[model samples]
Target chain A: MARMKFLCDAERCIECNSCVTACKNEHEVPWGVNRRRVVTLNDGVPGEKSISVACMHCTDAPCAAVCPVDCFYTTDDGIVLHDKDLCIGCGYCFYACPFGAPQYPQQSAFGVRGKMDKCTFCAGGPLADNSNKEYEKYGRNRIAEGKLPLCAEMCSTKALLAGDGDMIADIYRQRVLKRGGRPQTWGWESAYGASG
Target chain B: MKTLVSTMAGLTLLFLGGCYESPNVTTYEPGVYKGPKDPLMMGKADQRAETLKKRFELVQMDR
Candidate 1:
């Protein structure tokens, strides 16, 4: 099994929001909902770090645990996804998720929360691969086409990485070795825990 | 005597009924996924991983 995961290199990230733009463009994600965003720590400081934030698609997802409707499912590649039709817009997953990955769209004038949406790792949802219906509901099915997420692919600085866990970790390890420094893989420990 | 016997039988039934168990309800299991299966899982995962490995080597390894 691949165990697909996302890793953001804080040292490499320049907070350009290219990943964010790439995600929005690729998915046509709604106005209020951002599937991916860059968060910068210690703003205005010279040594500040920025990292791209989204669902880590954890080995053991907290959102899945807290969902009342049990709509969440993990793909064979370890991508965390939920059926929008099954989601009740309860916002439990939002609270449970450590990375704040679960997002609800406010489509109506009343500001009523829509179904929960989160990062799917570009694997799409529980629908036919590359179908129009699936695209309408869950955006692109790039994983089915053997492609990684566009957010990572379009990243100019290669700060955001999406792929198999072990492979990406090896890549990061190599980067660290070359750079000769200990750099944090931000949110990995909380999302995936120590063993992951 | 008949009244006493009826009371005893009723008590015994009540006691046995207290011990009767009902069928377990089938709710969603914790940590188990209850949603529809994804399309990506339908293909050969090993082949997919291999393809991804090649991609990583191409784009990520040298960077």
Candidate 2:
């Protein structure tokens, strides 16, 4: 099986923020931490484009490289996840991540930094599949349940595609061909590198 | 009075001595994943992929 990936067709996205809402609701993500969000390049401007953004789960993930505690790991399906127990909340991953995927739950001066949180591709953490502990820490294990990420599944415009990288690439290629133009897929090269 | 002042000075010096910051340098080994093994990887890869493919066809294909 090829690596799992996400593709956001910018031409089709309508900036509805439904993907963001679905992810937050699915994961019961804590306040101030968003697993997914819609980014608009030019708000209220003519010909503005919006795309849903989250952890792209990069091929050579910078987050894993810079982690002081060595908490981050990539799965066989290319999903990047981290051990919250080992995370020191030092925010190195935040700086290292090009997508700005890492998030902290709080902002306090008492030196009490919360654990780092990011999108898990709905695969949950290292814990047992669909277990309570895994869900509590890393959200639902939709991948284990034979389902794709909710953000892509629930996209109102079908703009967000998530699954096998090659499969989604084919889908996007077909869309572009049918439309008779090459529409930009946001963040594809950045997240997966130039090869994909 | 002399002895009391000396004691306070010594205590302050001790506290200062203990306040030195530890170095934050880390030797990063590239491509090494130090986190726990994901349970998903333990399952059959072909079966999981087939299931996901069916799901994609059911819900995510060319909609």
Candidate 3:
């Protein structure tokens, strides 16, 4: 089975924030919660590189490791998912996650963080595939329809690539090879002179 | 493996002793997930031509 993955090619990324918007709109994610975000390395700089960030769904997820309730589970495709029913809203996953992917909706009166929510890789939850219940909590199941993550699909520059790991690695590698080397990366000309 | 073997043995003994009417245990094979298909898988790809076409369509995205 293909190890499902996402790779944002910094070279092609334009920091459009389309991926973020796509995620929110598709999932109807609650207010004050962003499943995906754009992080630019050098703010306001001419040659800044930005990559859309979210739950990387690591091989051995730290969130799973730290979750006291054991809500987290990884799919065969390596997409990490959590059961809201099993979650205790403890925020341990939040602290354990390296990318700050876990989010809690501000629903309670006294600033109580609600159930942990994060990027589901557009795969929804443990419920039946493409079910309305799954859609209510998670987002659309584009994967069920044989499509990639909506974030990657909505990417204007095709910079945010999502699919099997090996396939995307090859794509990114070919792009690099096509450019002849890594020095001619994105914004290289804007950062330095256009002499190669 | 030892724990699993012991658990299975205990379950078998319980069944044989008639103390356990119906066990709700679910034994799963290793290296496979048998949960509800949330975001189900598409069948595998056959060749690069399809990939190239898909990439082209995405790259042509004007939005």
Top lDDT hit: 2
TM-score of each: 0.83, 0.82, 0.73
Model 2, which residues run further than 4 Å from truth?
A107-112, A184-196, B1-31
Choose the strongest candidate by TM-score: 1
Candidate 1 lDDT by residue in tens digits, A50-166: 999999998888888888878988777788888998889989999988899888899777878999887888888998998998898889988777788888887788888888888
Q: Write the per-residue lDDT of candidate 2 for residues A1-196, one digit (tens) a residue.
A: 5788988988989999999999999999999898888899878998888988999999888998888788988877788889898888999999998888899988587756699999999999989999999999999999999999999988878999998899999998898889997654446774587787
Model 3 ranges off by over 4 Å: A183-196, B1-63
lDDT of 3 by residue, B1-63 (tens): 999999999999988898645677777444343344433433333442255336535643333
TM-score of chain B of each: 0.53, 0.49, 0.29
Q: Please report, as a residue range, the 10-residue window in candidate 1 chain A with the lowest summed lDDT.
A: A182-191
Better model by DockQ, 1 or 2? 2
**All-Cα superposition RMSD per candidate:** 7.0, 8.1, 10.2
Write one digit per residue (lDDT tens) for candidate 3, span A31-94: 9999999988777988777888999989888888887766777866788988887777999989
Listed in order, the DockQ scores are: 0.42, 0.44, 0.11
Mark the 10 consecutive residues where model 2 chain A has the least summed lDDT: A182-191
